[model samples]
Target chain A: MSSEVRRIRYSPPWGDASIIGVAGSSGSGKTSLALAIVASLNLPWVVIMSMDSFYKPLNAEQSAIAFRNEYDFDSPEAIDFDILVDRLRDIKQGRVAEIPIYSFEKHNRIEKTTSIYSPHVLILEGIFALHDQRVLDLLDLKIFAEADADLCLSRRLVRDVKERGRDIEGCIKQWFGYVKPNFYKYVSPQREIADVIIPRGIENTVAISMVSGQIQKTLAHKSAQHQEQLQRLGKIAEDAPLSPNAIILPQTNQVKGIHTLLMDPKTSTEEYIFYFDRLVTLLVEKAVDFLPSHPEQVITPAGNVYMGLKTSVGTSAVVILRGGSAFETGLRRTIPDCRTGRILIQTNYRTGEPELHYRALPKNIAEDGLVLLLDPQMSSGGAALMAVRVLVDHGVPEDRIVFVTYLAGPVGVNRVLSVFPEVRVVVARMGDDMEERWVESRYLGC
Target chain B: MTDNTAPSQSVGPEYLPIGRKPTATVSTNLAHDNVTILPQTSQLIALLTMIRDKNTGRADFIFHSNRIIRLLVEEGLNHLPVVEHTITTPVGRTYSGVKFEGKICGVSIMRAGESMEQALRECCRSVRIGKILIQRDEETSKPKLYYDKLPEDIAERWVLLLDPMLATGGSALMAVEVLKSRGVPEDHILFLNLIASPEGAKNFAERFPKVRVVTAFVDMGLDEKNYIVPGLGDFGDRFYTM
Candidate 1:
């Protein structure tokens, strides 16, 4: 029934990743400036992406000059802005992106690429960060790190001769010939468009706080929007009948008996655990009926051949951590060797919005015949939608996935089904949408 | 095998059967080669007394009986085999240890046996459980298989055979036969129960020496009606219905 219900389009908080571009002359403390901003924000999702990693691989002729420190590394032409812009666009939309690892010593791009996913804010630090028009379009905040010209030259001299294995002459030669000229022609012009300019870079606390405050405000705005979106979706799902995709266990005497024990206030902890786990087993068992099977035959001890649809294959599970951990026993009981993965989505206590904290999925999950998303309780279905979005982004087909939970509200189930109409949900019981999650705390004993 | 000459195995690495799977609130009494009865400790006896009383309600019977059932299941896991394992500690020194190493499933005799399913699932997570229903032939007074549903890979897993009361060894014996016919080795099955008649324990042990038996209590013997003397009445009726 949820399929015919109004659907709400959703994008995770990470989907609209904010981009901050930091540009400066070589040795002008741009790296320090970005780090200071990160320290002020005090967030894990804020990432610092170096523009040096996107440097164009030099030809043999240019490489020889670079070896002599005679090549122009400071010029915007040397930075591969195309790949940089593509990576920025990917982060802006919360897609997994591979960043090239360029080797300065070898003057070539390494074969390996570091993967980045779900970054909420990226600090693109390089001389050309604000130089490219495509990159400028993606920037949410622009910062130009400034330092004295003589100071920058001296810092470059100390940095190169001591750390980069360059001689004093080569350092000075590159500083005057390439770095000095590039700052005037290409780098200085970016300062005109910068939202904030930091003089003395990391030492300028006033500027750092101002920039961090603006970013924090932006995050608060996004979080408020996310919570509003969830409430809107919940309202749409409030009265809709459960979709056929939600396969609750047949309410037989056995299932009802377990439910009574679970709901009773006087049930002992041991019995509560036993019956809950038993109920979980039955729920997962019902979930198997949703899995596709092929006909196969087995010979009984009586030497008679009987055809069976399937013994189970190619099925894996993704546990939405903590609450989902409660489903492990039930999952293990049903599929003893079933491969498992984990995704941690926690609610913001103040904002009432769910945030994706961490995720580690099994290899080639998209290829699995079926994937079960396990969580013991659902009220708002905010986390469910995000969890489903995570799986969909990872290449698992929506139709091949199932969200399994022990207790859920109609609105939560309807909301998830409305967005992912193809994906089914298996819940043991329907309870109040406002009911708090106590099953996991009781089961985990924490 | 009943003497636990074989080591215990778990899902992780397994070395030697360091000791029997710990029985937190119960201790071993008989220690026979194939049978283990919970010793009459003050703790064990008190729990037994509550369930044995005829006036005891279903709620108390279930609560007390489950305590012993948990112990029986742990004792059942004790008979599996284990392999030697070594690991490096955080202090950067090697520590020789052992871990469990095998898959396990439960087979519950339907009706009464079904009561023990939760306990099995409690001790073992996501444990695949099969159901077997047996009824006595009124004329022959013999156990007969009425229905059964089991895991497809039963032959390869360590089986925990669950039945609350063992009397006359009739149902337990027939249950083992059903498992063995399905290719599960006699040694791989561990019969777990809350109470047993001495006659029942003896008959079961003599029949299947390889299948280990773990019970919480062993009463004196069976009466003419085949009911265990001083035993809790019709366990299924008391536990399921009021």
Candidate 2:
């Protein structure tokens, strides 16, 4: 198998796993066929779990009857379905499961149990595997192994006599009395649910190969879909021209000086904080200019009317957490009475997906004439997108929201603008490289 | 002559100006871009602060309310349509300038809306004025139009719908319906208010998207009593000393 396929096969617990279930009556070679497929796949991450391990431990009287071939083990009621369903669900969710070990000779569970963790491929082989609805629901693929009734009985006779230490007459009588009747009643009916039927059981190598190929194709498709989603999230409009919705503050010497301090690697944390404050003030001031204003005339001290512009409405500011909080002081300084709200969004370290941890906005923030969305830095724009979605869902008008950031990449800004075109974006500086500083600081671990 | 044969491109039953699409399409939410919130100028903010203060007496309240309303009306008129014209300067040189286009009219939703009428008339002298008396049924909370007196040729004029407070937009919507019934196109109407709640503005825009909304400020939302919170309490009650 290719390394990419292997990576998926041994992916994290939350990753998708392909579950194949094989079902057939005794002596139908269901276990043998499952083993052959596993070996052919040559996947160390594949796990095979036999249904025999789910058999209910028998009482002394029941054990004696089972040993004497008087007790029927082929019935669905003979298996502990509750435990089996629980373990299957656990494995499906990438969790560890403890499977019981059953001894056929003792007709009971052994003292020890086998711990099974999540695997890329999970195979469940048994006569009643397809009988339970719960088990069938968890399986991605179901295969039924079939053989001639006479041939199955002959094989059963040989195996029971040698491996099981059962006499010929006893095996024959038990097969006719319990096994054959139960197989027709319960196990044979499950063929209707089988996705693929192998007529010759283990000897049907062609059918096994086809089932394996189908599973591999499904896995490949899932992997491709996951990659596409990641690409969509990370995509930035680098080559495309800047969107009209973006408002890059004019590169004045003061603005450039602040950027120099912010971008310098040798700048101390205190100096970085101070310079960021200065930059944020400028960004907030620029964003305020976007609000609607009207011309006004006021009497001057010289008894002359002077025409001026006056702001028309109130504004509210919503800051994204951590980095976004840097703009809080600047926003307050600019609009002292402006209501402030906060949204906490963090990137999951393992999954790299942004998660909203918390959000607190002023009551009736939706009605505010303007909402200033503050985030100091935007890399992939994933967190900003999520924050914007939150505001939009709360009935805030998209165009009324002005997303203010100190520094942003072209990709992040474009990503947000594409999703929310009407939302205005104001940034002090626009950079092409998103992760250069982080990489230099060893924050991203290269 | 009424051009009834003109193709109706508007989404609603009311006629809108040709070639002007509804502004709601600019965003999925209420058209915020079409709604202009005046900047927080110190003079305006100071007046608003005085009006919102509980300790302010009726005289001060009325004085500040009128000042703010006049400022808001002046600001609102700036959004009205204008046409270019040329005139001879005293120096005998031709000066080109823009002049207000179309006739101007104001329809006030009584009694809160009546407070803004004086300011609107002050700015547009000799402007045609109209009144719409829509009272909320205290029990039902539904607006019932009791009376309306609009201009005869209102369809050809730019009508400014004036109200001091837009809480639930029930009265504003009724007033707009009355205006549209009078044959005034939605695009030719501008809804001007001192303060509005988001819900009220959203509801109004969703119903009459082509009409522009110019407000001094938008408070949070209405309380259970349907009054705007942090709002200058009941503009009509405070202005009339009721």
Candidate 3:
């Protein structure tokens, strides 16, 4: 295995989230500009991560200053750039990042946090969105929303009075004392680095459309790379022998009997469903048997000590939907109380690329002792690879995952294992790598 | 069980065409304990008519049958217990409501039984499903369990036993026995089907008095072929082959 080693990884369309920094003076419509771009794109994956969420908690003196409307919140020093940059980097690398929630009314950070993951485009909008060098390095597009100074102050007065409950005098006090001055000292300088300067903010339809177009283009390019990477891995997998981690159930008569019935086209749908389900249950049991366990003594009903073993960690499963739906019966059979998460990765008809349509994973799946990726069959392993990548991205360790399938071609098995050598593959039988997926439809009957 | 749990709608009996009601022909079968036949409504009758007609094409058959199956599943869900739940509204007010008290899963009898699986899925998100195959032993010529894949925690969940047709009731009885062996309470199991013969209904309710049977239509009786008359012929064959 060590003699011919090659490492490859599949990157989803949102793998490297394009960070777009929207910086401008307070009340200049930075948020509105981000919203406009998102509205034009009309995509669910374009997330607007407000830099306001990263506002640093204030000490007693600073809190008092903030209460008096004398705090320089518009300045770069007032924002926690270190934490902001750390999270931005995590998003850029397609990893989970917890963003702190700040309360402007309380002038402090809240105890709870919100998380960001798998965003196709993240609009980092705030007065100092582009001030940090580290942030500038991660940003793919830099936008500066501009408006007249008088207009900015008036918008601030209306917003503070209605939403923040600020008195008119204090709003004016902060406008001149901190916000106005900070715009010149720290916020205004960011415009020099901005790629697009849109005056009148959201009213600039041409600018918003341009920004949205660029983002769509970037996404299309990333999707192309993902498809190419999958094919590259497949080519490597095609020539290699099955990974040692790919474990096939022993060819017992029971296993063979089930497979024979399943492979026979003349078999009635009733018998096909029966045998396929039987095979799936056996596959799940085989996967469970592979989980690490420790032996202990327990008192039996006969008043005698019995030696038994228990798995060291709680196991959860992620069902790759549609096809994975076929495994629901078997999965319940093996672990009736098992927590299950679902990920739907559908192969695009036009491109033969597996695109992730939806995912709802169990909480803290990365911490699970074992995570089984359930799919009834694997041919080219396109969906399986994407599904595994999802779990790994969500924090599940590669080694802790076991790809459970009723039938898998050698190419598909090798493809998944070659990319994730540590992960184990539990299969019932092996056949044509390019075989059309018929079992999920056969079993699901839809 | 009485009709108290039946969900009422503004679309009333006035809409049902005369002499075309689900309850009309199945009154005799309803005398069996723990059996609930779907209420008579023109919408349901129309769907049954499309499926039962021999001239109905495959696409029409599947589409109409699925609609009826969806209704059967919704009715089946009414039997599940619910607990009062209080939730706060976004307007800073709280309202009391009810939520399902326990988890539920579907256990489909293979082939024809799998037809109901999709309907159950449409009603419940990520609901776990199990499968049981009880076919004749061939040698002994008796219904024997070939395989059963039940959830590990089935004993704790209300099991929706799915099979499209109920005729002779041998396979269903064997399936119920399998559930009992797995520690599932008889009352917790709801046998959901599209149609059932009178003989099968009587035989099933008598064998397991606690397991409720919820069917869309109860046909007159079984024919010599042991198939439900006026019932869509060979549910598994029609469902899969079509």
Label model 1 with its docking quality class. Answer: incorrect
Taking the tens digit of each residue's C-alpha lDDT, what string does model 3 give over A264-359? 555677767766765676677567644544433333222222223333577899999888888887677546778999988888899888877788
Which lDDT tens digits does candidate 2 get at residues A46-147? 779999899999999999998788888878889999999998987786555789999888888999898665365789999998989999999999989998
Q: Candidate 1's residue-wise lDDT over B118-235, tens digit each?
A: 7776667689999999999998988899999999999999899999988888888999999999999999999998877777887898889998998887655566677765567788
**TM-scores of all candidate predictions against the true structure:** 0.64, 0.34, 0.63
DockQ class, candidate 3: incorrect
Model 1 error, position A115 (Å): 2.8
**What is the descending DockQ order?**
1, 2, 3
DockQ of each: 0.02, 0.01, 0.01
The true-versus-predicted C-alpha distance at residue A278 of model 3, in Å, is: 2.4
Q: How should the candidates be ordered by TM-score, best one leading?
A: 1, 3, 2
Q: Is candidate 1 or candidate 3 better by DockQ?
A: 1
DockQ, candidate 1, comes to 0.02
Higher-ranked by DockQ: 1 or 2: 1
lDDT tens readout by residue for model 3, B1-242: 11212122222133223332222122234687589887644345445655665555776667667767866776777777765555542223343434456889999999789888876775564899999998988898789998989899999999999988888899999999999999999999999988887788888999899998999877655556676654666666666785
On TM-score, the leading prediction is 1
